[model samples]
Target chain A: MARTLINLPKTAKAGAVIEIKTLISHPMETGYRPGPEGRLVPRDIITEFVCRFEGEEVFRAELFPATSANPYLTFTTLAERSGTFTFTWTGDNGFSQTESAALTVT
Target chain B: MRRALLGLLLLAVPAAAEIAPGERRSGFDQMTPELRAMQTDEAANPGQLWVGDGEEAWAAAPPTGRPACAGCHGAVATMRGVAARYPAWDEAAARPVDLQGRINLCRTRHQGADPLPFESRPLLALTAAVAAQSRGLPVAPPADPRLDPARAEGERLFTRRTGQLDLACAQCHDALWGRRLGASTIPQGHPNGYPLYRLEWQDLGSLQRRLRNCLTGMRAEPYPFGAPEYLALELHLMRRAQGLAIEAPAVRP
Candidate 1:
């Protein structure tokens, strides 16, 4: 399983825009690069990333081959209530990982 | 008579000025603001991914069915400050072994597993994790008589010119540090931040890999990985960086 890191404030004021950051380890190999014996390396990349709060989608991104290895994303979302934020990353080679964090709204 | 005296004074000057202890700077201080931010933020630092893997490996049993690291050593947190004094003398091997070597020794002697290949993900991951425990601690090379000869050899290697460039490491790192080389600023080549993530490589690498990169850049044949020369150089570097805080799993551009 690929390792991932998620960062967000444990508590935030209601209606505040809380920032969230994430990073995951993946080679994100581009198809154009040549491997041993001059053959092209096959493309493999995280196809999509989704962040949801309390089962409601908050943000989503569509990744491409050009994306760098170990994809990192940072975005802000309004904190309305206390709940868990779930993150899902789906990629080539049937790679998928899910993680969650709790945020309390004051 | 005045001209002769001036010539004598000029000849007396050393070839290169050694960097004073207080004047030394870690590669972290030389990084750009953006890169510095990347290094400080755990969520943004890609090196943490390896640390995570390392945490798992530290506890998981290998195919040998032997006890895991935690089974003997307990939680990895107890390993704090251990990495700072690496490349230490190994009584069994009758030589100096760096932190990576020590880990591999444990694998072979205690865990009954084959040594992990150099620069492999598993090795880098475990090394990074162990070194991360020493973060913020000062680099304090052990005060052992046996290490002196190796450290001297390392110093000699650092000063001796080599490769097609015929330039010693001191030329750029000690004397010309703070000067621009191409688009990059030449920072004092310190070893505090190691097993770090470099933007150029897009992956974490060991100090040996980096040293080999420099050797290749100089058009010289690099010693094989885990070579004695590389280990000696690492020993000298750790001593040179004494009192500097450890920044393992650091980020660089």
Candidate 2:
């Protein structure tokens, strides 16, 4: 399970590109860090992220071990109409999270 | 340029009898350039989320009959430079009060609203909002004579070793400053970037939270939140950080 935050403008002009910011809390363990007993911490991180607006794909990204903890992603998409924007993240250890926010284009 | 020359002069003219010089550099100065850049970019700093929430909270009236903070204060911009002068001596209370205490005082006395718990999200948000208003202002606690006793007590507490590890705040933050403690460098331990978003915490937190973490690391029992000891320590820390720019809602690793 992951804690997520999604930021989207409450309203935007029709056809205007609006910025969307999302942050997910994940350790993004690189597997290189040493644990208390000198053992390597297991690697875990969100590997894929996808965003959809009005059921249509808008943005996508592939994350890696090099990604920092609490991965933050910001992107812009054209606001076509008043609708919901959905975000999904999948990663190691069978981790997955989904969150959505509503936006209105006046 | 003149400030740099003054700094050099101060360094050259050291006096054993003079009071210890305050830290000139901020913890932000020790950060990697990329991390520094993130803090500089308001859009990128995660702390801004709480600040945004704080802005809303300032305008929202609770169940109490009193008006919202915005109703009285008008614009948040007017609050600029206010946080930098906190831990001020409250004559009515006859003691020093930090920003958090001041907020709670307003809530109970003026708004008739119950005081928010320390470290609570609502409290942190409001504190962050007030602190955000003072961003970039120099930390300048009032020069009230009554605070001297508490300042001295705080200074003693800072140097007096305690806890299972027998460590004091000065041990790592002062004597070992600029040295590496594992992957992180020991900072001068100023209170400038309070209510900052520490990546280690993965959320916005108060200075008290950080201090508690330190005490825990030392195997020391932490004082309950809002304890007078913490306020005294805060007053001392603020004085130590005098002239340092406030970077509230700052980001850190």
Compared with the true structure, all predictions reach lDDT values of 0.92, 0.85
Across B1-253, the per-residue lDDT of candidate 1 in tens digits comes to 9999988878656522767789889988988899999998888989999999988899999899999999899999988988899989999999999988999999999999999999999999999999999999999999999999999999888888999999899889989999999999998999997899998899999999999998998888999998999988998888888999999899988
How well does candidate 1 match the true structure in TM-score terms? 0.93
lDDT of 2 at B195: 93
Predicted candidate 2 versus true structure: per-residue lDDT over B120-237, tens digit per residue = 8889888999999898899998899999898878877787798999999888876788899989998888899889989887778888899899889889999888888788788888
Candidate 2: global Cα-lDDT?
Answer: 0.85
Give residue B216's error in model 2 in angstroms: 1.6
Off by over 4 Å in 2: A1-56, A61-71, A75-106, B1-23
TM-score for each candidate, following the candidate numbering? 0.93, 0.74
lDDT of 2 at A82: 96
Off by over 4 Å in 1: B1-16
DockQ score of the complex predicted as candidate 1: 0.90
